[model samples]
Target chain A: MTTTNGLPPTGKSARIELVCPAGNLPSLRAAVDNGADSVYIGLRDNTNARNFGGLNFELPAARDGLDYAHRSGTKVLLAINTYPQPATWQRWTRAVDTAAGLGFDAVIIADAGLMRYAVRTHPQLRIHLSVQGSATSYEAINFYHRHFNVRRAVLPRVLSLAQVEQVIRNTPVEIEVFGFGSLCVMVEGRCALSSYVTGESPNMTGACSPAKAVRWEQKASGLEARLNGVLIDRYGANENAAYPTLCKGRFKAGDDVYYAIEEPASLNALELLPELDRIGVAAVKIEGRQRSPAYVAAVTRVWRQALDACAQGTAAPQPRWSEELRRMSEGQSHTLGAYHRPWK
Target chain B: MKLALGPLLYYWPRQSVVRFYEEIARSSVDIVYLGEVICSRRHELRLSDWLDLAAALEAAGKEVVLSTQALTESESDLRTLRRIAGNGRFPVEANDMGAVNVLAGAAPFIAGPHLNVYNPHTLSVLAGLGVRRWVMPVEMPRHVLEDMQHARPAGVETEVLAFGRLPLAFSARCFTARRNNLPKDDCRFSCIDHPDGLPLDTLEGAPFLVLNGIQTQSAHVHCLIADLDDLAGLGVDAVRISPQSRHTADVIALFRQRMIGALDAAAAARELEQLAPGATCDGYWRALPGMTPPGNAP
Candidate 1:
């Protein structure tokens, strides 16, 4: 399955790009100052997946952020990843036009029709397939590359290390894997769990488990978390409470009640830097465009150091790096996610 | 107004699967989607076995479709998908884009619900690739579908999920195996014991989701027999009813009766509630939480 398309000849020769998230102007600055090679941001509209309130860049802020990132030698990528409805398809195309016109480094897209528009109307804009595209296999990635001229494809956090290497070996498109962030148990773009509970989903609305649908009531039984009146989880008086993302909530399966789908943990693949670099992955992405600037700075700083150490062949588990990332991670814990087989 | 049976999402024993389809051969379903859409490891029925059943269903005047898996990771999985794409006998239901790529110009196919077609532009693109019909994603509300139906490409048909548990999500990790405390590689085919999938409930013991191998489905069945007139008004071509371990024939017959105006929607809904494995909900149809009752929505 090996192809000699874009593989780095040696591990040391590859310079794995560190891609960070920016939801606001300060976060964009934090990523750039902390040594991000590229910063991806979404617009204020629901055109992108992280359509949270008071987050994302308006037109003026986006222009400022783009100027700042480019001035600091950091590439700015526009994320117009959500599927555009019939009446609003023009909005998505306009977003692509805006990004290309404003000189954003690249535009990450998911929908096939939008990809066609990007390729046809703005052919020179470098296209990156967002994880929302759900192209888990190299064949799928190759389909997008062949049809849309996508330069890079962010692999979903579902493949094992060996499977990812297989995809990297097969496709000429650059592979980007998630390096650190809050984990999604379900495959991106394909999951309907949130919509089933709240009618808004990442595919249609660019939001999952929307805050408006969430209700945290101090019931007599315990601290109850409900999504649109359906019970998601309940914590005892002494137990710590976490945000009620549908997948991370505890549920009763078979003989016991527990976190049946997934635990409240973040994915930290800092330890896999050497392997990712060796695998010819063009980028390692940090997921969370809705966090504080401090969270962005801390994560970008740690990942930058780790990727550098791996390139110098001095990479090893450092207590300080792990401690810092743990503090910023969801639930103060992390897993290797699907990059490790046992996690599956 | 047409009824199509969705592909079975569970791994049943060989005899039960054969017996179930043998009965479906004589049922009133117009189209039958046949194959493994959940986990590739569920080898109770391989491609040949599915083809045999497809032939049997076709012999009884049913349109048969071979469905590909939702998550294709292994090289062997791709090989299976390629074979299905090239089957040539039956129309294929593509669950992922890889399947769509292989089947693009070869022949026409049906877009499975997992393909995530939320907009008319995406539907038109798939229609250009020879998609004759596109299944609506289960969680899409009626308003969105109305807009898509208005602008959908000519000759492209729309199908809605009418009955059975709504498949909410798919993951690489097998929750069924995880429930049994086993790794996915050596899952021991544990899903065979539960023909309808193992139910997962909230801590307070309310039915929530069903864990069927790698796929998670709503514990409540998504019945739209009451919305038959609305679907027809919107020009929907077909309605799909997912298979269950018990009472699938009765469920299909009820929907058929209601579709023909022989049975009232209220009476059909009442009967279906009794026959369904769990309570019924249509919140997603009304643009609210899926678990919300149809009457509770604004």
Candidate 2:
């Protein structure tokens, strides 16, 4: 099942867009300055999935990014992707209104209610169904497209490249897929592992393994990281530390105790750029809004050149390109993730 | 409130599954949801076999609704879903949007717990698409359900997960298979061993979660036998008791008795704790962290 794209020729001319993430104002600028064709951002509240400490844009900062991205010829997509609580729906609706008022190019959303709000309130507002929404098939994606008039849908990380091309051939909607950054083992919106431990999640509260529930202490044997009093990991002296997320942590399962769900790693899909373009993928996304601006700059710059190479008919530069990205990955490692079935 | 038996989350032997439903058919359960909602590979019962079982249950005067998979990534999963949706005997529960696409604008189908229905607008939209009822995700708080109920669409029913180990999450990677060092595609149906689920503990030996193939469930069963009055007060239409390995019928009878004023909340709580697989918690209903039992201060 190689990438023999069955989708009608995407004109052999449509330049695939490079979408990047922004955690804060600086990161937003870093994405724009580093050749990102479009930048996705989240507001400074639970309305967005990346609501972490001292991160995300407040109203004024969002206004600035909106202006800056438009002036720089880079599109801005606001990620109000979290499911708003019943009492909290008003805030989410207001967030959509704010996005429309600020002239954001699109609003990435997961919750159906929020999509309804955005659609009814500002019908012209372009909507991109977030991967957090968990629409994994063309049937699912088409449901959203027909009902809500969604312009594009971000593919969940669970699909292989063959499955992706199969979906593209079936649906009229534009497809955006994750290219690089921290990987979620579970389907995005459907997961509640974070809230099950920390009372926070990307779906319900827009936070995952929040820092407040995180505690790190150096013991005699190793450094221990715990989330809400549950020990996630213990690292021996000289062992590099990784963030304590329930999915990434080591645990006792059957006779073997290991990183039972997934290891601390990031997803880098630069190697598949040409194949992704041939499959008619409209955009390739970078997935870290909880990262530093330097991290954003390093990843965005590398992917930008790789994407341009497909147009130049040049092979993507070798070991150096991968080594530079490895330095930015979680645990300094990268996998093509679900794109290649062996990672599963 | 109405009582529903959610689709069994475990992969029991075919005989066990058939016998379980045979007992449920004679029990007090009003709605019986049947299907392979967790992993598509669990083949003890095929879709036709499920429909055959559905016929037996429905013949015994029970409402039947077949449920789709929680994670429908493959084309085969969708094919099975289309068959279930087009079963034409009873309503179908749309667990994923693929199921929704097939069931929409035809017959009224259920919006299963995996669908995110936290707000009134999403509820209204689903109602328009012919959702007769929607299950509350296990982690939703009571107040959120109440708010949605206040503005719920007409003819729409609200169902809350009342009992059993709460399914916290699902993934493409199978933890149960991985625990045995088996690749996902080549997994040897290891989930059938643990009829309840494989319990995962922390380093200090505190039970945290249960691994059931690709699904992760709560270590403690979410017992809402004591919260019946609160549920009634909030106008909740149905309370679903997920199928566990043991004492499920007694759990159903207890809810039936409590609903008919035969039992009080305190006594029901005591009896339910003894029947549950582990400790009982209702922290999600109280809006605290899900692990903490309700009424305990955070």
Candidate 3:
């Protein structure tokens, strides 16, 4: 094992949960075999936010993963985060029942009705408000806490460090902030650009940049990427063509044709872990349910070492940590992303 | 079956905004959503001015709803929201859960589009919390709406963004200010320059998006005048006509005529398209890509 269970805080600051993503059985083992305090996975169906085919877990796999994590004395959080359509509302409620029945640690949810049902039906089961719920303020976080008795709330990636601290200072619920992964740029649960082009979105369909609509072409001029029928980006000679997610697309805003909203970069908050610890962020989440086991192994290893050293009062963001993180990032790059005021 | 004026998405001069609502007070729209829903810094109209206009619209035989900011961050923003919800005048529209916190159980409010109320169970919970009406999220298709209507909580009216450029996304980074090479704190009100929002085109020279402060809307207007009968069948209580700088009065009248059966879908779409900013698309209503307009099939 490259890391410990990560349940007890090793740093001088409070115990901060290192919540990691587990898209499949191997990724879940990579996280548990390394050092995730808790690992969150989704169902294979569209009931979960990461509804990509050939990814995520089936009922048997989910039950198995829960058994593996619980036996290792690690927590397993099930993500039933996508907003269910009226016709499919029963599926979400049933997922909640399944998660509770499986004796999972907590169910991370986004829909209001789902939370209400979870709290009413499974009163003993803990609820962590999913980031897809997009609660950025203390009042909003408190609303969930007051009504549904949510034990934790994942703050959206839009707030700055100072704003995050302010939100923590005012709310009673445990706060979980994004530690690493692809940035949504736009507010999650609100973006429609993917659906506008691909007719699928995280809020409705539980998928962003659905695979069916993506097309790549090597034309005479450059490498071009298109979503549905709309051309998202074109690359020049010797340039790396990053995956065409809607927010990261290069488009024309005014006179300058550039990354209009956000550049093609991943968010790495490794440097801010110290500050986040001082601010009392109860957990740090890593995004990527669609990533492979190798990707998870590399990221989870670095984060585990750093977080452990920080808990032991020996934390130094070693040079190798950033270098490793950079190699695995989108476009081989990363940013603080709205944590610094200039980015906002 | 009914017409409601949505909150204006773009920032305009104070006089122009006042005049736009002054005309709206006498228009065919039955309900009017007021206030700056995009940017908290767009102080062209103060809270008092919005309240006064709400009073004026109520006097003109219209129901008034106060709309809150889509993204509430700063302390001042929350302070403004608490005041708006507790203002004791009209039903407040909770755009975000921050607004819902202030209005929960104390006053009845409309669950604005930003609330992300997609399924019936969420609607049922909000109805329990005193949400009298809720605007369906913009990107939802007709079948989703039909499903929601089937399991909808009792007595809560549903509104849809039946007209105008669909608001695709909102961000903390103000794209309008970013386009002008300015920081958000020192934006200097550049969003006022484009009353209908600054347009963005694709590299292929195709019209793409509209940048209004922190919001990105579709370049082409989204018209559902062609689907009024379908909305009625789906039990949509109100059809929202989002405010545009030009010919919004005409948009309202056209929608109103269709709502009352004074005009058929074919004639209504033709008249409505004449007043649209660019072209019109209703693909999302038909469960297709939002930018793809359902062709003239009716």
lDDT agreement with native, every candidate: 0.91, 0.87, 0.88
How many backbone clashes are present in model 3? 4
TM-score for chain B of each model, two decimals: 0.99, 0.98, 0.98
Would candidate 2 be rated incorrect, acceptable, medium or high by CAPRI criteria? medium
Judged by lDDT relative to the true structure, which candidate is superior, 1 or 2? 1
Positional deviation of A171 in candidate 1, in angstroms? 1.0
| All candidates: TM-score of chain A | 0.96, 0.95, 0.95
Candidates in order, TM-scores: namely 0.97, 0.97, 0.96
Q: How good is the docking of model 2, as DockQ?
A: 0.77
What tier of docking accuracy does candidate 3 attain? Answer: medium
Best by lDDT: 1
Clashing residue pair totals per candidate (backbone < 3 A)? 0, 0, 4
* Model 2 steric clash pairs: none
lDDT of each residue in B133-191, candidate 3, tens digit only: 99998888888888889888888999999889999998889898888889988999999
Per-residue C-alpha lDDT of model 1 across residues A1-344, encoded as one tens digit per residue: 33343554433238899999999999999999999999999999999999999999999999999889999889999999998887788999999999999999999999999999999998899999999999999888998888889999998889998889888878889999999999998999889899888878999899998999889999888999998777889989998899999999999986698889999999999888878877778899999999999999999999999988887888895889999999999998899989999888
Interface RMSD of each candidate, angstroms, one decimal: 1.2, 1.2, 1.1
True contacts kept of each: 0.73, 0.77, 0.82
Runs off by more than 4 Å, candidate 3 = A1-13, B296-298
Which 10-residue window in model 2 chain A sums to the lowest lDDT? A1-10
